[model samples]
Target: MSKILIVGAHGQTARIVIDRIISETDDSLVLFLRNSSRLNEYDNNSRVELIDGDVLNTDSLVSAMKNVDIVYSNVGGTDLAKQTASILEAMTKSNKKRLIFISSLGAYHEVPGKFGEWNEQAIAAYLPGFRESAKLIENSNTEYTMIRPAWMSNKDEIDYETTQKGEPFKGTEVSRKSIADFVMELLSDPTQHIDESIGLNKPNTDGDKPEWI
Candidate 1:
């Protein structure tokens, strides 16, 4: 019966998480996306309410957050920090505490070896924003869990492991389904990683970079 708000509803990772939520729980969901037309696929889902709005607009974010119990942010890109700022402001105004955010693994420059070097070079422009967004959540009063996932793949499996914020990040290439499963686990028990940032990766993989990459 919990009401959860999902921003960046059209994202691949968000879709996976939403599917898992719909299939496993009775929780009502509010999906926030910039374009309402993109919600046609979910028209028959009674448990989902689609809200059209930009995360950069605080008023729109606040409106979407109304009566929302938990907020799941899957937004990325260079504007991520700005969007996160708006989300934090709206959540504070609405008195919503719980947040689950998706970030990238090398955002902290924690990934080591060749893959780490490659990731840094590849996303050099995006990492700073991700890092800033993480700091924003860390300093906020709300209960937040930031999930920094390793290189992702379309692999059809849900096998992954996690590393704490300060721990050295390990492994590479976790499936989107695995990340979704982890999010589902957190949704089932919100108290699991309160105010903690975690890095996720596929287990037992030993390589500098993901094979596919």
Candidate 2:
């Protein structure tokens, strides 16, 4: 069984991934979060190892990464690059190679139409850092898959499609569950799409702007 380490385990997307992992597989999970108190529900899960660690602290990250085979990061914030850089450094030091990262659609300026324009303007400061993090992963020697997902919703659906780096990002919004499903697939089969940066969106969502916006 694969020993998967999920950074930013308290995140909404990561929570869904954790639930799926618990239900669907016998793989072990290292759930890393800044606050261990946030994971009260997982206290009884034997397969889930809850650890408190800051992504910005290399020593903390290195400690959290011990015996981990794959690292799936669901981190997001204005300081995205710094966090990712730390994770990469720790991964390198620990000799852990496989990585799956979650990024934003606007990070690559891939969002299209009016929605894309709005997204760029909305998260102007944050997008650049995400882009930088993507670059950091792309330039690394680690086997990685960087996922850039469009505007996310809490909608209950798992229907989504993907576009590679150069392609125009399709649709306007994708559900968090859809993103979780995709991530789970990648974690289940790490060899697939080893070095690709993919843009994800719900199929048939073409519009001038996202429906929710």
Candidate 3:
């Protein structure tokens, strides 16, 4: 069983992915989060281990990378660039290669049309951080798959499609379950989409903006 490490284990989609990982695969998991106690229910799960640590701390990140075959970063914040640097530095120090990074739409200005403009205005504050994180990951030596999910929703379904880095992003929102399902697929085949940035959204979700907004 491959050992996978999940940074930012408290994220909503990450939680779905975690539950699926336990139920569907035999892989062992190391869950790292700032507040590990938030998931205290997993304490006795044999295939899971929890660590409370900061993603910005390279030393702590390197320690967590030990014996970890794959790393999934579900973190996002205003300091995402710094966090990405720390993750990359620790990966280099630990001699680990495979990583799955969760970025956001518009990080590369790949979102198109009126919807794109709307999204830009909606998340302008966080765009710089996402862009910087994308830059660092794209320039890194690690085998990385960066996922840029569209505006998120809590819908209870998994129906999504992808666009490559240079392709125009489709749709305005996607269910978090869809993103988790895609991440689960990547976990099953680490070699798929290596060093690629993918845009994910529910098929047929195209619009100027999400329906709710």
Candidate 4:
């Protein structure tokens, strides 16, 4: 069975992915999180292993990556650049090539119009971190798929559409469950999205265009 490691295990999106994996796949999962206390909320399962490690702690992260086939990261914060740097360093040192990263729609600095303005205003507090982290992943040698989702809601539904690098997909918010579904889909066939980035959004929703046009 494939060994998968998920960073930010306590996040809502992460939890959705975890539940999907537990119910649909036999692959083993290693959950990396800063806090071990929250793990108890999840049902005990033999397929799950919880590791207490912050993404910023390179040593711990590297150790946890041992024998891991895939790394799915849902980490987010104002210090995203540093955290992503640490994850990259750890994955490189471990010789792990598969990565599925969750980024924000604002990472593309050139999308024009009011939607861009809205994105800028929404992420202005953390734009630097998002931009730099995305650049690091883009330039890295690892096989990676960076998924940028529009505004996220904690809704239970898992309906959404994805747009590849060439398409424009931004505007309405998508549910965290949908993002989790996308990650699970990628995990089922990791190579399908290698060396690519994509945007996700709810269907038929119209609003300000994405800033990352």
lDDT by residue (tens digit), candidate 3, 1-59: 79999999999999999999999999999999998999999999998999999999999
Q: What tens digits encode model 1's per-residue C-alpha lDDT throughout 122-170?
A: 7889998999998899999999999999888988999999998878789
Pairs that collide, model 4 = 111-213
In terms of TM-score, which candidate is stronger, 1 or 3?
A: 3
lDDT, ranked from best to worst = 3, 2, 1, 4
lDDT per residue as tens, model 2, 147-191: 988889999989999999989999988999999999989878889
Q: What is each predicted model's overall lDDT from 0 to 1?
A: 0.89, 0.90, 0.94, 0.85
Total backbone collisions for each predicted model: 0, 0, 0, 1
Full candidate order by TM-score, most accurate first: 3, 2, 1, 4
Question: In terms of lDDT, which candidate is stronger, 2 or 3?
Answer: 3
Error of 4 at 90 (Å): 0.4
State the lDDT at 12 in candidate 4.
86
What would the TM-score be for candidate 3 when compared with the true structure? 0.98
lDDT of 4 at 159: 82
RMSD of 2: 0.9
lDDT of 1 at 134: 86
| TM-score of candidate 4 to 2 decimals | 0.92
Task: Find the 10 residues in a row with the least total lDDT in model 4.
Answer: 204-213
Candidate 4 lDDT, tens digit per residue, 147-195? 9888888777988987777566555678898888889889998878899
Per-model TM against the reference: 0.97, 0.97, 0.98, 0.92
